[model samples]
Target: MTDGVTAAHGTGGHGEPADAPVSAWVLGADSGGSGLRITLAAVPEGGAPQTVGTVTSTEPVRTGAQGIDAEHMLAQLVPAARELLERAGERAQAAGLRSVCVGAAGMATLGGQLRAELPAALTREFSVRRIALAADAVTAYAGALGQLPGAVVAGGTGLIAMGTDLRNWRRADGWGHLLGDCGSGAWIGQAGLQAAMRAYDGREGGSAALRERAEAVFGAPLSGLPAQLYPRTDRPAVLASFAPEVAACADRDTAASEILRAAAQEIATAAAAVCPAEEGVSVAVTGGLFRIGEPLLAPLREQLHRRAPHAHLTEPAGDPLDGALLIAARLSSDALRLPQDPALLSLT
Candidate 1:
């Protein structure tokens, strides 16, 4: 019951007459720790789809005992979808949203509610006939390689590596800050802070530079950092905030340099663990962690060279949002081929 219906008039919004045909539309969404992004695209008959409009929400969807809050997500998603539909003009509303794909962070583990409820909700709102709910990692792979055989490493506040041989998915890490997500932003920041603490304790592996940076960033009496950090809900993001300082000190501090090297090794190892064994398989690294530049990427490149020599490293083609769109477009056309899993990707 979202408004803006124009199908009865039949105008295509391109100066076409009331009898002109309108292209079908699809919706794609990416929801993660940062926020949610929704995109609308037009899929013309026998032609490639093109993005028509997009909307973003800075507030991340909430999670609860049942898992990712389905109703909470809908509260944000419905308004965003409607906004896009309106912005794309009356033709888009008339053609209608036929399919939707959502790629969310934690979908593999916390998507039970989303899987159970989202399809029905979208069907009611947009009359969508098909839906694909996927783990953000899977979408990251699609965005990076576009259905090609490859491995994709997504590193942000957390990290995960995903790959496929066009048959099944293989994943490594992404266990969260406390358990795994090794070499992720949180990992790097935690390592840096540990080095800082070691320096404060006059330990053998201590780095005075890291200690200084930590104290400067976290305030004097670094002992107080624990109280400031541990009680928060956004601990991973809070921890990740210090990663840039670690990279900044890498050139002058042996401990920082070693931390980056170790992190790089861990990231490369994860990528190797999931990378398809076929010769010349592609591997791409995506996310904000790499933005720290040479302090991280240089060592990562070296580690990748050593651990995954047969797999060539490449730049990502797009991002998780783009991956969701690709999935939506393919699902609408009945051409989706990515392996499906109840947890990672469920098609309806």
Candidate 2:
């Protein structure tokens, strides 16, 4: 909480009261499958931006549920944002908290009561005059490309590819785990688990090491796999957890290596789907997949070369939290003029 610490270090003057308006700062947050990331910066009149606070907290995963689950999702999001608001203290009233922008995982598919609920909660809590809500992938692209005309592949628990060249914009994948999200962590994990089950039954000529690993995790014969998954609320995360193990075993297990190689291909193909194979476009790669290094990246690099050789590939300039801030800034000016999508909620 950078801003909180700085505010606390200020003069002996009293802090802003809880009931006052937060009018001087802009906040950006990334809400994802596992957690929430928030960053705040104060924009004083005619002065350089001063970063004040940032926070990371756990939150519910959005699995594309449209009704009651959407309310439940808001139930999780409000508290994380509230924590940041409270950090601003009475200074929220003094500095006069301004606008907030939030990017969540399934925002592209968002609608219904949940969409309406989030902005109301933010306004009431932070007393900000304006709010912007967008798909985390939108911010991811902006943050990764620095708002340049390029494409970005965001590979985390799920996967999505988005690209823009001012004149046109395109998006691909991000269909979620049930139908798509190929080359995502959940996708790789599912592939590994299926291979393990096949080896257990001698069905796929799978790797013994993979089978042994599964047995060790799920008990002998692995008969309890369904029991482990069926009753859990966080089934996707549970399944996606296996991806790290798959990547770890890729060097010693054939099935694991094949799963990673295949996952890489699928993700690369997704990137190519949204980005044209042109000479001028540059693509940035982000998310946990990049963190796994060569085991996954080697194949992805090869696939990208083969699939979209004319496009350039590079590391992201910043994470999604940064994207949130970048877009919020854009909204204030006409910077890159983000397109209006129904999934996005803009309150001013």
Candidate 3:
């Protein structure tokens, strides 16, 4: 129906104008523990693609026998994609709503395991040309550098660093909050609380500002935390909420300063580890922790200088959501080249 052409539709904020008709459309979605985001965009015959609609909502988590739970992602992705197309009225379906590309957490390793369930779950909702899925990390790399080869460090509630030389893919830490995610907001907050509690216990000295922040977060002195934190559900999220206050205390608070510095070093270590030794490799960073640029990035850059003197640090070209959109675009266009191979998925 599209005749190999596409256009965007829907109405309202982040959506297309009510009067415009779209030739074809596709969705790019990014799903994580926090939420799911989808962008509906238009692809045309000989012109650039444009985003016409954006939708976001929380979705149910799906489970599998091996703990590969991409079905949780598809549950949300399917409904959202259908709803957006419906908003475009009968025109969009008639013109051919093409495909959906998902950049999701835990998807990279799932492979055919996730793919096997796609048709039953997604096609039942709407007809599409095809669906392509990859790990959120893959989308981060593709979204950041496009066809250009390099590494990306995405640190938000969690942390992950990945790089590619077009021939080989290199990856560093992203082990989630418990085992790793050294530079993540969750890490920063938890560490800040522990330090403040140590000072409260008279075991160490900490920043007054951080201690105050911790008290505010816990609704009591540091002594009260151990009981609540250990038994609490959603501990990472609860702890991460205090990260901003810790970042705010930076220069004037020694404990805060040290925490930020340590976080910066951890991020730098991951970023540096993934980049190839070869020169001209660019490193881009994305995450909430990096948002407090000076208190964090200044130290990160310095550490990277010492660690990988040649790697260039730069702002992320886009966020994971943007990366997801880029992935959708690439999947629909054969003319667009990607350097990915099976080995990249192996993360060898």
Candidate 4:
């Protein structure tokens, strides 16, 4: 940890204490389509850390809106995250916090976009060093499986598949909202919208489950959906928010069911691409899409199993924030060691 001078770099309610001991503070951040999440944990060597707390913020990107540039999204999000870290540090100070670690979206892949930009943003706001950044998927992958080599599929506002061979790593399908996020929430919503459009055109002769659900939830008629959905800043949510209703209609409506089935296929394909064809790979599913239950996971698992017979499946042990903290704990001059904390055990 840095001296109080470095810790006192930014202006919040209170600066760092002159006499505070420099301990380990673990912070993880997930800046996804829905919003932003910051988790803080206080870890002492060989000791279990008491939960400090979590700070929730918003992603710079609007849930469903299009046309907003990446720069604009980062501008809005970077400040919120900085404020969150400062806030967490202050809270940890009140509760006794010393070091911090962060796991956030864009941290891993959005290099010029997030890596350099974020560190500068933080330093401008606070005196912080020892920051470790990785793909949000890394946190999820690590959190779900600990140091073991495995693959994780996240189907949320965006879809991304990643895996580590415990040595080598690979990833695919994080195309964002425009090109293709194959197995993402955006994909599901977009597919659902297509189904609705087809139904409206009479090209398809069934009630479009996605369209009906969107109408029910947003109180917006299906006829005017594109107009309402496209012009707004939160298009992803406007579309994805209907996910539950789509799931409900999947069994009863062919169009809706087909959309879900297609999503499962895409996810399975991504999983296969990330994992080796050889047996014994571990795979796990997480994110908002899986929360919808069997409508998604069951089909996805079945498809993956058919492709890779020896793969193992498991539920996420802890959230990605925990994974971020776990990553921080592992980053060392040499190698990371397991802490005595029980809460952290789940992360590994």
lDDT of 3 at 324: 62
lDDT ranking from best to worst?
1, 2, 3, 4
TM-score of candidate 4 relative to the true fold: 0.71
The TM-score leader among the candidates is 1
Better of 1 and 2 by lDDT: 1
Most accurate candidate by lDDT: 1
- Pitting candidate 1 against candidate 2, the one with the higher TM-score is 1
Give the RMSD in angstroms, all C-alphas superposed, for model 3.
Answer: 5.6
Estimate, for each residue in 204-247, the C-alpha lDDT of model 3 and write its tens digit: 66566777778877777677777987797888777788788888
Better of 1 and 3 by TM-score: 1
TM-score of 1: 0.90
Tens digit per residue, CA lDDT, model 2, 1-348: 112222322110123333333235677777776676666655443222244566666644545446324555555455645555577666644654467777877675654544667677667766666677777888888678766777899987888898776555688888889989899888888888888888877895567777777777777877779788879887777778888888889998888999989988998788888885558688888988678789998998899889888888887877787778766655544343666566643444
Clashes of each: 0, 12, 2, 9
Clashing pairs in 4: 25-99, 27-101, 29-103, 64-234, 64-235, 64-236, 65-233, 65-234, 65-235
Off by over 4 Å in 1: 1-23, 44-48
User: Positional deviation of 146 in candidate 1, in angstroms?
Assistant: 1.1
TM-score of 3: 0.83
Angstrom error of the Cα, residue 323, model 4: value is 1.1
Give the lowest summed-lDDT range of ten residues in model 3.
Answer: 1-10
Q: How accurate is candidate 1 locally (lDDT)?
A: 0.86
Cα shift from native, residue 223, model 2 (Å): 3.2
